[model samples]
Target chain A: MKKYLSIIVVSLFVLSSGIAFAYDGSLIDDTSYTGTITKIDRGARVIELTTKFEKTPKTWKLNMQDECQIQVMTTKDPSERGAFKKFAELKEGTLVNVYGWPKDGKWLARKISILNPDDYMVKRLEADAKAGVFFGHEP
Target chain B: MNKKGFLALILAVLFLAGTAEARKTEITPADQRDWQVIAPQDSDTPLRDYAMLYEAGGHDGNIGVIGIPSMKPYRYIKMGVDMHNFPFSGSNAGNNNGTPDGKYLWVSDKGADAVIELNLQTGFAERILANPKPFGIHHSAAMSPNGKYIFLTGELSGKMAKMRVADGATTVIDVPPAPSAPDYPDASKDGKYVFSGNYYHSAVMVFSQDPFKFIKEIPVGKNPHGTNFLPTNRWAVVCDKLSATQSVIDVRQLKVHRVIPVGAGPLHNQPDNFGKYNYISSFVSDSTCKVDLGRMQMVDEFPIHYRVGHNSIAPDNHYYVSQNKFSTGLFNPTGIVFAINFEEQDIDELSPTYGKTVKIVPINGEPHEGRQIFSTTIQRWNTGTGGDLFAKGYELGDVKVNFDEKVPGKGLTKRPSLEPIHLAAAKRYFIPRDDGKPGVTQEGDVTVVRVKAFSYGYIPRFIHVKKGAKVRIILTNIDKAAGLTKNPDVTMGFLPAGYYGQKTRLDGVRGMSAVGEFVADMAGEFEFYCQQFCGPLHLEMRGTFFVDPPGGTASLSVGDYDEISKLEYQVSDPSEREFITGGNRLLNTLKEGNEPAL
Candidate 1:
């Protein structure tokens, strides 16, 4: 009984302290941008996207390298890393979060995580309806 | 009294106190302003036809705002010559560059040895950024792609300066080969490098903007004048005036990739939006050549009237305006010298008049260059976030800079610091029924005069003072373009009260009051006017300074056409005047040939 109680206390303490030891799926970066791809220049290996979280919307052209990591998220979390992908699989209108820094006058991409559609507001509203959270308002 | 009645009286007292406190913090009907966001306009809108043209030459430096398509004159904004220490020498205003968002325009006043930043929304000359030591003659400037830095070129000083846009923190480097003159500069689209054309060394000097260091100088043809990078950020094409060819520097390799023959004296060049065609203005040949960028060769040429100096494509890529020099036979001849003309050529394939001179607008003074801006790019009002720290409402009527302390013996005398409340009350003096007082006050030996500047006029239409009195005129601008009207009858209308404040320090902070101090020496009836184009009544915003004579007697002098009529006049013969007018008409009728003329 004493051992069980001690284990329960430790578990509560760890959870209360907010140290979960789980990956949030965000990459380390000098600068980061999460936006939908508007254009893809194959010859230059550059993709243009309007920045998501900025007071003033700005178009950023990021250069993709061969060694850069490209992943597609599977979970509802927008930043969750899931499966590996190639540059050819990337398409316009796909939402992505990029981690990069300026290199040789170009924004060189270090990592690009293609966000899951369910993480966005529209898909989340539908998920909430399936869960019957909205009651009579659910469509 | 009963216990219940006494308790009710106490409750009533507490309720009254709470009501009094609530009224103190209540939002006034005027203060209850909710802002609405305006959607960005399309770049192809016809409202983007406004062009800003500048002349830094003989006839007094001024910026002319002209209309396109119709080719009509609107108004000219006088670049503050009477306000600053550098009185805008009518001969040395150089190149200008606007920010990516078009909120502010940076113009180089070489005569003042400073780079002036103008707030586009209010048309106010906001800040004067002085070139650092060892560098003089601030010639040209280019804004970075991200709008964070301004790359400045010094022609006579043989130096290049990089100024951070947020604060005017500057770093200077020599344009290598010791005596090279950096005439014109252009920042790369990727914001990595600044390419400057060196006239003396005949090379285009490249500098890394991040570390602010000289990278390399690629040898080009003789007299490299204007350097412009294509949209691809791969090639920087430089017009070599003396060699009559363009040196295309491959930015990826940092080498001169091709030297294509363009024409006689190619002075300036600009590439189209698609990076498909490049236009090079040939000064000696009186034509502009269009080069195919992919082929790296001159494909077509369009003849402009005479001496094509600078050329620029419109924002929508609908047409190109060729700034031609030496008016000659284009306009009505005034004297031995004539005025310049801005000739517009249609480039839009959808338009009926493609590759033709659609209109010609004659203008006074010698204009060096012109830039076209879409109205949507400029902010409706400056919020102090768009790199203009000295914008109105950012600093409320307080001048923290001491000009006399920085550069002593200059006209502005020393000013004592005042409290924030004193600065706030300075504007209230102009408004009656607010317990306000007159502006002019005597402080010790100096007479302090406060001038309240707003949209249409300045307070105190006339200032009367004794001769030799030390006068300090502190001009405070209280109007802001941030609020809406309270009338329910009118919708979507904003208050017309935006103006850029002057008096920015060298470090570019804490300039709220546009202050100037001078001894009233030998002053009769000197006139002071609002230089910025505030509104329709901007010309009416003028005031006179009346200084009394030595005997302390105020007097006035009036003059009329009678004085002019007494002077001898030289009249041209009627036949000579008729011939000149007929010649101008014939040239206008004959210059409209269908040949591709830009």
Candidate 2:
């Protein structure tokens, strides 16, 4: 399998500002997104999942950017989640679920669920991302 | 090498197309304000095209209404500045103070040793000879409540320049130079007493034109930088930068009331939300501490950013500090405004926990003044919390810092103490943009990629996504000035905001670009933030992303001016936002080969 990546540049401009609150119609309603995680970046506290929505399973990302905001979930022990500070720890095959929308451009996750990372299927994808090959983890 | 090189080249193209940036723009009478999150073209300014204050969810799963939170949250218009065009000079801008009418911006240029009057309405820039002979005009240009006299500090020249505003005349009052005089040559409200900080002389010089003579000098700490008079002319406050202490001097008596050890490097400040408690900024630790004027003791402190030499308190308690010299947070306007809450924690006087401590919280509000990337830190601090901090309902922080500074002085004067605000703020805010919708999209192909650049402190911002073919994003915060992050191994650049609680770690001192690349595995919106205690709005530092449909959305043309202008990049009302921000030569050049040229 082949893997590819894209890079985007960023910049800024100066303007005489006058109440610059642009509109907010693009964001998907928080309740609209539903999916299950296929991976988690523990150190980054970000989880990727193929969610099973009421209509369809959507793929997305979830995170508690600040660790203090990361509530200790009963499903994942705080120690095991220790990797929340190091993204490499989340591994490719972690089974997780998420609910979020397209904020900015990518998925801006709002809710997430951590399925048992021990799930055998998850380990498979983990092996794939590491092997730098195609990891069929999509739901 | 041949096979891998080919694939690598292609991947590089996709990766190159996915970088995110912050651009703060406005709309024309053409209406509409949908924020468009576009990747910054390779240009000089950064953070102006992306969104800011991107919290992943702190409000019980509700991040600070970051750019229209109700929808898919892709395009959010933010507030920031063009760092490349910043009114830069080696000297700090004394750009503080607006006219009593609040219509004009007073650009205090410390380096030029002059005041530049910026007519917001006309966009005209003019210089005013505010003072004379100060090599480093630190700041402290006090406008009379009546706008009659403008009292300013001559930082290096070691003098105070007092100007009579009523007649457009500047009279350089050769006040007796303190050991380190005129850190900020500001005056007391009553107009009867003029106070200036003697940073080098370590003293407070006091005088008023009524007598035209140096009345008294109060001895203070190592290098008192800022001086402000409590609304009541009876007292004056001084902030010592080097030693991180504040001194209170009896205005009439011309005597030192009490010198208290506040935060690390107390530089600029404001009053509490209610204007009763004075909140001062601690530069080195990047913390803002508060003082209960009544009790006269250092109560608490909150973390902000480093080398925050300038600050302002809104008419409300929310305070702001300019991210000076530091590139990452350099040109951010809303990024500078820090909401603060200060309260007296009861403690037994002698015990470690006995003395009362102050608390500071940053806030998010509409940048009331035109988004000039710079808000004054001299807002009047009130002691009362006014209301719940940060969230909209509460009273907004009352501190407003104005820059257009230049004043004339009489023949003689003395100096005063230096210290800035009270404490407890929401976090940090960098740039702002409208939360617009995703651009034209193809139906099927989708891949996710993350770009993790620059990692510092805790709270490393990561972008995660389903790993197929879309351009997913995962960003790393290398800005050490982000005050919200914590790490014992990193030495952060916030002392005035008091980041000392998190000892200086080896990783704390890093340039703006930290890790540089971490791809998202999924195709979705990604979130990022500063993982260390950078400065005032550290927590507010955030950027969002979008993973293109796997095949990548092909555009009609890259350099079509009309298409680029009308394509609705990241703003809903492209015309309106463009009218205010379109003159950007940099924006045009960066997008020259990519987006249509405006």
**For model 1, what is the alpha-carbon lDDT of residue B408?**
18
- Tens digits of per-residue lDDT for model 2 on B26-52? 343323332231332111123221111
Global fold similarity of model 2 (TM-score): 0.35
User: What is the CAPRI rating of model 2's predicted complex?
Assistant: incorrect
Off by over 4 Å in 1: A1-139, B1-59, B80-99, B335-337, B379-598
* C-alpha DockQ of every model: 0.02, 0.01
Q: Rate the local accuracy (lDDT) of all candidates.
A: 0.52, 0.35
lDDT of 1: 0.52
Per residue, candidate 1 scores C-alpha lDDT tens digits across B1-598 of 7999999999999999999999997876535542121332111234434433333331223456566544566665554221111111110101122222333556664433445555454565444444443244445677664445667776655678776543455666677778777877877755567888877778888887676779888899987887987654557789988788998887767999889999887877766543446788887677878876656789778788766667766533456778776455667866433566778787644344556777777875445556654333334344545333222212111111111212111123212111101011112111221212437888999987666665555577667777778876666554552112111110010111101012110010012444455565543443445433233223234555566666654322422112222211111223212111111112112221221110
Name the DockQ score for candidate 2: 0.01
TM-score of each: 0.48, 0.35
Per-residue lDDT of model 1, residues A1-139, tens digit only? 9999999999999896664343221122223455679999977879997754322345788887543545553334312323456677778998776644465667766456576555432243234335432211001
